[model samples]
Target: MTTASGGMTTEQLREHVATTLTRGRERTAALIEVEPDELTAQHSTLMSPLVWDYAHIGNQEELWLVRDVGGRDPVRQDIDQMYDAFLNTRASRVALPLLDPTEARDYVRTVRDKVFEVLERSPLAGRRLEEGGFAFGMVAQHEQQHAETMLATHQLRAGAAVLHAPRPPAAVVRLAPEVVVPAGEFVMGTSTEPWALDNERPAHTRNVDGFAIDTAPVTNGRWLQFLLDGGYDRPELWTTVGWAHRVQAGLTAPEFWQLDGDAWSRRAFGVLEPLVDDEPVVHVCFHEAQAYARWAGRRLPTEVEWEKAARHDPATGRSRRWPWGDEDPTAEHANLGQRHLRPAPVGAYPAGASALGVHQLAGDVWEWCDSGFTPHPGFEVFPYEEYSKVFFGGDYAVLRGGSFGTDEVAARGTFRNWDHPVRRQIFTGLRTARDLTAAERG
Candidate 1:
């Protein structure tokens, strides 16, 4: 099994750290000229001040992983006292000394240099270096997370013009209406795999019955049909919780889409664009997804069903990391890393389809599931205390797959992400499933 840094060769560790640092530097350079005042000009629910967030990324890595645990001191030690999210209210506005954007960039570079020097000087053959390797892993992941957050900040700060919309593929591929999954026992959640997050641990076996899942995610056109059919207007289609959520938000349609006369258009990035009829519907909340599924005579897959279908079955030659196989993600294969910065037409990446013939299972937009955020049995918290435990009973729902902004590591199948049911800011959407017995036969 691949360990985070435990079993890695010193050369491997050096290469990983160098590559991660290069990525971080590139992301930092991208936002150096973004006007700070412009970033804070609007009350965007989707973003924070670009400069502030940029500094916070470095501060978090240095404070939490290096200084706090690695027994090193921060170059700007006062940052620890000022920007610690655990100590300061995340939502409360506070006046504090902040570096100019350029200064912040310099500080990050200085920290990176120090980290690189330390790694270079460390003795390779010992547990001490291994501990350093682990610390580097933590820092690398911390920066990866900030990379995603920074992308969101960029979209909000630079407006829609800066974020490119994905062009429709030259040809559209319509998937089979449904794929039938046979009833059987399958191992649910992560096993003794290499480097799984805490939430995916304590893998257990689960028994499931035959079910039919949509071959592709629900599309904007399909969801619009539901909306026009009074899907949201009818209370019968919504759960009690869902109805309340819809009422509170006063949502008549997906957050980004609107009906102009008889034509449908949506706010792409920050500008209005004609809705691509075949693109997978995105930015819809889980409540909306649930209601739409109910209206369409289907349901969201339980986490077990999703996992079983997306992963491979040992007995059936179906075991693969992604739906397509154990290959690394490529630009042509999945809509991720802001490659197109917009949701693509469903089934655009036939190469990314899962074992059950499900398309876009790993990337495009994050798909909401029917499961709540809870620990698997024998689950142990990771060293990062608040990552999972803080949100266990919160009003959040589980979203699988990574979105356009998600990094390759976070986009792993075992990675679990959750947000409140009302969050529609992120690139979130859904697919539907139905019990075989309840499926409307053609």
Candidate 2:
């Protein structure tokens, strides 16, 4: 093994690649370990069957690592289009000649074994994709992303509680209602991250005027107040598009929430429990979050503002890799990697706070930003264009920070996630921000 790109030796890169792949597999197993094969069937039209995602993960590894990177013969060339996401829609995928659960497990195992063999021999430095071991990292991140998708399907599936984990730690610090971020220029994306995908590339300087953003995400308790105040009923609080969508969808509260008499409860992985006041609200769509921000006389932060708050260190005037620092995330930093079933209570993970005093910026729930999805200044299509180039438009709203379901490999300060604004199935939430008054900025 020798040094290649990103200043890391091939041995170090290989370890990282192996560790990431192993963790992704472990997570996939945990999500489906006890569920019967029938449970893996198409649970929602919005998402592919668990079995499809299962084999797709393996298929991608075989395509990229085993075949492309290693120059090996195809393992299952017949099923290439069967698992091609661009070729098949999620709703229609159930009708495809998909692999059974047993077959899926075996196929993934076989592909992974081949991958390991290739990984050991490859220099991981020659081609563009091999530079910095990007392909390996990309595949690992892809699997983790699918794992999170599977977790979402599990949440949508109806059943008694099948998943359990310890509750996130209680809040250790009391944060202010809002923090003022002075007007300034900050780097918004990543140019140096070896594993960062195309949309996050070509880091650029962005100048944002002074604004005051919520110290933490909007909480369920505050949302309860909005609901009680007829927030949904008040069309004035919602944009014309949002109000129309709300009416059509009949969205009265966050997904999984249930009301009984005077109290509210939420369903988590099949268990119904009283909603906690302090935990950040999850499963809310961009429309819901935007409406709530409007009702509160604020708005969701732009993607740039979100990144600045999560990465900027005031003293050094530089962006840190994460809110806590450039160091890799640990359990102490934030709630991530399915370590918990839900978001941590607000004010938790004070150690995860950025230099500007922001908290929970790394994980908990995906926070919706006001910005629409687009490319950076110097964006270019890489290994493939379908991964991000197809989604570069205003149709998709951006979300920053990872969720409790997100793995560290797929979550970083500069990482970008975007989806249709009406989507609520993802683990999504929001934190509000407002422009500073003249006196305040002065």
Candidate 3:
């Protein structure tokens, strides 16, 4: 095997690939520790059955690693079409003949067993996909993404709670209301990250005007204030399309939330709990976030401004891989990997703060940005175009930072996630930003 760049020897690359894939499997397994019926049942039209996701993760692995990279025949040629995401929409998937929970477990284990053999023998060099174990890395990230999706499904599931984790650490320090990001250029996206997806590629420079961003994400307490002030009742706070969506959906508050007499309670993973005032609010769509921002005399930061706050370090004038630094994430850095069932309270994870003193930029709730989903300056289609290319358009709103359910492998500084502006099913929240005043800019 040829020596790989980035100082990763062939052995280290192989180990990393194995570890990444393993973490994904572990999370997927934990999420599906439910009844067989639940595994096959559709929790919501917005997501797939847990069992379908179970085998689909393996099918993708087989297609990319075992067949495409290793030059092997299909393991289950007949089942490929059923698992193709584009071939069948989520709403139609439940009607298809999907593998049973037992069958899915066996098939995925069989495919994974073969995949490891391929990983051990295949050279980690040559073709772009093989170099640095990109295929394996991609597969690992794919599975982790689905794992996060499954976690969201869990949240949507109704019943006694089946998933649990210890609470996230308490707030370590008091945070300022907002941080001033100076006017200047900061690197955006990634040119060096080995596993970065296509949308995060071709690092470029962006010069943004001075702006003030919330030091932490907007919290339940603040959202309560918005509610009390009749923020949703006021149509002027919403955009044309946003107002329409709000009216059609009757969106008076974030999803899963209900007024419990005089207090607000939200359902999470089948458990009902009173609103935690200090926790960053989740299950809010871009419209609600935008409306809330408007009510607060602010707006969501553009993707450029959000990236600059999360990545730019004025002291060194370089963008690190994460808000904290180049180091991989740990328990102390962020509340990731389903470590907590919900977002930690605001001001938590001070260690995860960006160089600009923006707290919780890596994990908690995905922070909605003002920008629509768009390609960077030099975007290119990778291994496949379906991953990102198909989603490029103004219909989607860009969300930065990873949610608590997101895995470290799939969540990073340059990692860009977008969904329809009306989507609130996945864990999402926002922080507000505004242009610096003339005096403040000076």
Candidate 4:
């Protein structure tokens, strides 16, 4: 589909936008209300205060939808500077004279009201921004992205587990360890996906050699073996920068992990829980994933390889919009949104598995790839430069797939996520791949 409003008439488009925007707003409000006032006020260096995100989301909506598209006046011109994410760092945002929670809600509500009016009268089928309601989809996705960010902030906060959900029911899964993605040319990016970020535009063909990818992500039990074997102490196994970072951080295990005598446990959201042996190990940084890959005699899949594994169908010799097919995600498919506070067991989502039988390729944890953040052949900056252009550099490692904290609207197959290799605060992990060599076949 070219856009979320695809196959819809003007009124249907407006209703779709209204529904999506409401989902995002409700989640944002819920997140703000979930935490204690003091916790929401305090800023973590890793994230903006909840209040900042609450208002920043509104500022973005007003800027793009109301002011930019609707040609309306600003809702709160004075607060623009305060909520401008590019203008303020996470550390300083907390110090801003932000609106209280009640006021923030009012501000967003007012912006939304104006937006609905604009949607009602404005033409929905002219220009790139309005054609197929691109702007509306963009804004809703942006808001949902912030809602996921706010959800991450909630996870980073220290408190009781305010977010709750039922455990993912265990499914009968294929225990096969690896699946071979046949070597071939496959499309890597998207031009038809309307809300796809600029970085994922200009879909291009990527040629990858035959390789075997693990059926499931590395599990807590497997990572425990790495720890037992002095994975952190073996400087030789790590890149120079990674080794130095490991030393500087005095790291023995993943963040939120504790090694008490011979036992292992991790802080999930707010409570201490025994690490589930089958769940994909979350909070692993790229460097850690890399080191573990080396230990396993494999390597993190390149972004191209990851996409092929997730989107390409060797049988049909074509690409799919999502791993399971063009269909959007459903609760039966993957663990997503804020519906679950943590990842399900590694082999839990059989229906969500890729065409090649690569499990957990959609959601559970953000899988770290070996590629850095860079644009495709004809990448264009859309909406603004800060969204993707500013972050184009080797400083960031791309992570594919969404996490438990990811909102469904923001977690498409072509969705691109990147972070510093050493960042362990987000829901992150990796699935290792190795080339299928002739010697192995012989």
Best by TM-score: 3
TM-scores of the candidates are 0.88, 0.97, 0.98, 0.96
| Alpha-carbon runs more than 4 Å astray in model 4 | 1-3, 440-442
The list of candidate 3 runs beyond 4 A from truth reads 1-5
Q: Write one digit per residue (lDDT tens) for candidate 4, span 1-442.
A: 3356567778887787778788888887777765448435764787988888888888888988899889998889989889988889888887778888778889988998999888887777777887767888888888887887777777788768777677765756756888888777998888887777788898888878888898888889899999889899998779999899999988889888976677889987788878888888988898899999998889999999899989998788878888988888888789887777778887678888888888878878999999999998889898678889999986999999988878777888899999999998889988899988996544
Q: Which clashing pairs does model 3 show?
A: none
TM-score of 2: 0.97
Candidate 2 residue pairs in clash (backbone atoms < 3 Å)? none
Of candidates 4 and 1, the better by lDDT: 4
User: What are the candidates' C-alpha RMSDs?
Assistant: 3.3, 1.8, 1.8, 1.7
Model 1 off-target regions past 4 Å? Answer: 1-8, 31-33, 40-42, 68-70, 93-97, 121-134, 154-160, 165-172, 191-194, 314-319, 438-442
TM-score of 3: 0.98
Instruction: Tell me the lDDT of candidate 3.
Output: 0.91
What's the distance in Å from true for residue 132, model 4? 1.8
Clashing pairs in 4: none
- Order of quality (TM-score): 3, 2, 4, 1
In order, what lDDT does every prediction score? 0.71, 0.90, 0.91, 0.84
- Candidate No. with top lDDT: 3
Q: Please give the range of 10 consecutive residues that has the lowest summed lDDT in model 2.
A: 1-10
